[model samples]
Target chain A: MSAADAIAVAGVTKVFGSGNGQVAAVDDITVSIRKNEFFTLLGPSGCGKTTLLRLIAGFEFPTSGAIWLDGADVSDTPPFRRPINTVFQNYALFPHMTVEENIGFGLKMLNRPKAEIAERVAAMLKLVRMEALAGRRTNQISGGQQQRVALARALAPAPKVLLLDEPLSALDYKLRKEMQIELKRLQAETGITFIFVTHDQEEALTMSDRIAVMAAGRILQVGSPREVYDAPADRFVAGFIGESNLLPGTVERVSGGLASVTLSVGGRIEAVAPDGFSGGGPATVVLRPEHARLMPAAGAPEGAIAGTLATAVYFGTDTHYHVRLADGSDFTVREQNRPSVEARFHAGDAVAAVVEPRAARLLRERP
Target chain B: MARPFDVRRQRGFTVVAAFCFALLYLPIVVLVTYAFNAGESIANWEGVSLRWFVAAAGNAQVIDASIRSLQIATAAALIATTAATLAALATTRTAPYRGQAATFAALNLPLMVPEIVTAVALLIVFARIKMATGYTGLGYLIAAHTAFCIPFAYLPIRARLDGMDLNLERAAADLYATPVRAFRHVTLPLLWPGILAGFMLAFVISLDDVVITEFVKSGGQETLPTYMLGQLRRVITPEMNAISTAFLALSIVVVTVFFLVSRKRD
Candidate 1:
């Protein structure tokens, strides 16, 4: 509730049921969203991503906590009174009205002059690239057209924030990718804060300025896509945001803010702990697929461990290899499919997986 | 892949469908055609004439009764349809709550009970009121029609409300309209088709009702159906057929107009 922040949710908790049956859909979440940043809540299914969006939209109320918007406490304000709009996954266009009429409906309710409403509606249609379809009924238009109209309708009001709940989910794979870019562009042009919710990690990484990776009704970590991926706060964040090789281990020694850990698979590894830990304790090591280097031949070199290439999947731009260590644990390594590395390794080939001491992160071992 | 054109072989099924339609409509067809007969006995059909039609048109009591029925049906349809629309909106747009099922059952009770039962119940209530103050207005007929027509209006309107997209309303709210404004602008306009269809259906049903009207109506409160019943007891003439044919034409016109408007919306 200041010039910098458009919306702030403080200690918001949303519980679904009561007594013996209760679900904390959003548990004590507190976050301040900036004026015009495209913030996203990214998580898998049942992670309360959509629930948090609905809470911000005023469709659902917090069990205990306050939501402030533009310096006003709107915790108890109904959705219609709040200065926010939501674009649903299913573009819920009014079937009875043509695109022009549906878009002009809000202006009409404000008792705006008929000419003014028509002009604004026309401008909006042009903005959304749907001017040609203005006269057509909603059912007559395609899904993407309807989606554009829905965006036009929500944006026409020029609300302070636009809450999108998986608006691109209904589109096909190709359209989803296209609209992801379009949505970011639209957010940039409008300068309205967009609180987008999705279970898609790639969409979040591609579109959001900052992403909050959530799980089990709590935000496990919040940061830029690169920050969260490269330096995960916990094991869940590392596993949820992208593909990573998580190895269970215990610290053997701590020296100069770095720890040498021995894995359950009987492999010794050294990793940097930016957050210095107590010497000789339980911990886990996380290495991103891209961080591990694959070298031909058995037996580790100076800073490497021996493993066999159990499987190699050749993606278009990158080849991912599942490396099975001598002690029977398997981890994945992705190498760029460059011409130089094309014929480097194959399945069943003995290889040495190498990593820099700084590339590996010491995460808390999950019980 | 299997060919999509395999459905063409099923075209022969229309023959049986046509026979079934004929069986269903044969009696109404006979009734309608016989209304044009000029014979003294309906079975004879000696010739065709417009005399009975003219008589039906000029009958003052019949015309007044028809006007009264129209007025009551129109008023009842309006009231019932509006209440049903609000009820439908509440059921759909609001958050889930307790007591919603009990409210639903209460509103729909009249539809589930037999017409005779409702008629008797209304009669008793009206009789008690009449005995207390003798202040019976035409309001009784309006009340009865509205009660009977609510469920009819509710079902269709609720279907439309259930299928309605909340996105438009949310968009409207974000645009700065209050909740009431959103309902008026976005929700109501979208719901008009269903409301109109439901109202017209209720109007037709109310106009043709006999049992409840007979139970509650006082002297000098004859509706068209009750008047027609009285005419039947006294005489069975081509005049009745003429009246029946006119009513049938009117119903057809109403239904056709509704469908035409609804089709344009689609």
Candidate 2:
């Protein structure tokens, strides 16, 4: 554990049920979330992101692991004793309390002076810009406003770390977008380490300083949004983070975090060997549509892969060319529509797909 | 915007609903109306007066029974509600344990069992306890009523706990509130309507209990319902109707207050 790490989850595993019914909700996972950094646990439903967050919050006990908060082992500490707070997915604000009271509840629990609580609550209201409606009951407020109150309530305690469990999942699209930036601003202003759990890839990419993409109760990769999106760690991360054209290939050799792979269509391509890549086996090359472009097959570059154009889709600002390679695997190439360029090719035209250098990577496949 | 199969719009719906309403309320209406009869007999339609109400109020036996019923109901409602709240929290808050369903079934068994059967069972159990302890004060009735009213109270309290968002308490704990504090601030306030509803149900159940009181009571220990049952065997008078009307009004007031309080909370 590093001194700058706000939370260190070491081999944390949370299992539920017993006997024949036993299942690990959170498999053995080790991660270090930095202090003052907005870290996100991104995954689909039942992927154990929420369970992991709950473990760090002390709401759950890891079956056989230690959780360190600020260099102190707090694995056995109860939630109330931990210096962490959570903004629940449903905002779980006290329905009977006014917004001010809800925000002040933590301070009251901490036995802060009445005046100090009032002052802190007022500041929180102003931080969330809910001062005008501090006296309103939580149920009386709109969903967006309730979200703000939840944020304010969680922030009011000035906890060492704030855990947000898909807090934006309940908001409408426009409000969700707005809160994305709002949440980023709050994280920056507070300068507190925020551990956010979200299933929305776009939301995680937009707000997180670093993100841990999770699947099947394990962290697949932990990096900045750009790293995860640009160079995924495995097949699941590549397929889950964004759209990718997965072409079946075989790894000829691997060295220096790069893999030399021979495509099924009798062409050779270079791919970034993400973590979990095993040597000398069949693999799938992840090529983002934007990383490749289509050209006329006649007199095309020698390194370009040859294919037949299957379909072309217009998407206002870009056009997607779906190409069927000789191996029957489809590759999609996206190009921005420039006014100076002409219509490239229609459906069923022979085309050459050119992949940008160091833009594609093959990952180890589970047979 | 109309529904395709609105039950209220079905053929003969109004007639059927009215018939059911009459079947339920017409007898109560006649009883309340006759409570003001001037004549001694309840069978005849006499001039309207409050003579029976005054007579029932002045009668020492009726007064004693009324006070006894109120005491038992109040004590039982309070004890049952507290126990129900604890049981509700235990059942709903924790992870599902072995025998959880069995515990729920046992808690609600009184609601499923016939009242007379429970009365007889309680009579047998209490008879042994009374003989061994040599105690036959109001404690026996209160304890019996408390036992019978538990399920009446548990159902509403448990239903409320089920409907509540468990995350509210979790959020409290996350906010540094201890478990007890969480219950006080988050769970209890949200559960007020359910608690009040449970208390009312238990109170009403205990207040009018006749079979259990009749089966278990020692000499000179008559509740209002047992006293009324005893009166029915000898003679028929409008005083019974007067007492029933008063009891009905009190119940209506309790229910109305509950409704208003719950509505205002919302």
The residue pairs in collision within model 2 are none
Candidate 1's error at A365, in angstroms?
5.2
lDDT accuracy of residue A42 in candidate 2: 96
Q: Write the per-residue lDDT of candidate 2 for residues B55-96, one digit (tens) a residue.
A: 999999999999999999999999999999999989999988
**After TM-score superposition, what is the CA distance of residue A139 in candidate 1 from its true location, in Å?**
3.1
Model 1 docking category: medium
Global lDDT of each model? 0.85, 0.91
Residue B93 of candidate 2: its Cα lDDT?
90
lDDT for each residue of candidate 2 in A1-367, tens digit (9 for 90 to 100):
9999999999999999889988899999999999999999999999999999999998889998899999999999999999998999999988888999999999999999999999999999999999999999887899999999999999998999999999999999999999999999999999999999999999999899999999989999999999999978778998899889887778889888788888888567788886655568787888999998788999778768889999899888999888888978788899999886766899889899888888997765555
TM-score of 1: 0.91
**Worst 10-residue stretch by lDDT in candidate 2 chain A?**
A274-283
CAPRI band for model 2 = high
Q: In candidate 1, which residue pairs clash?
A: none
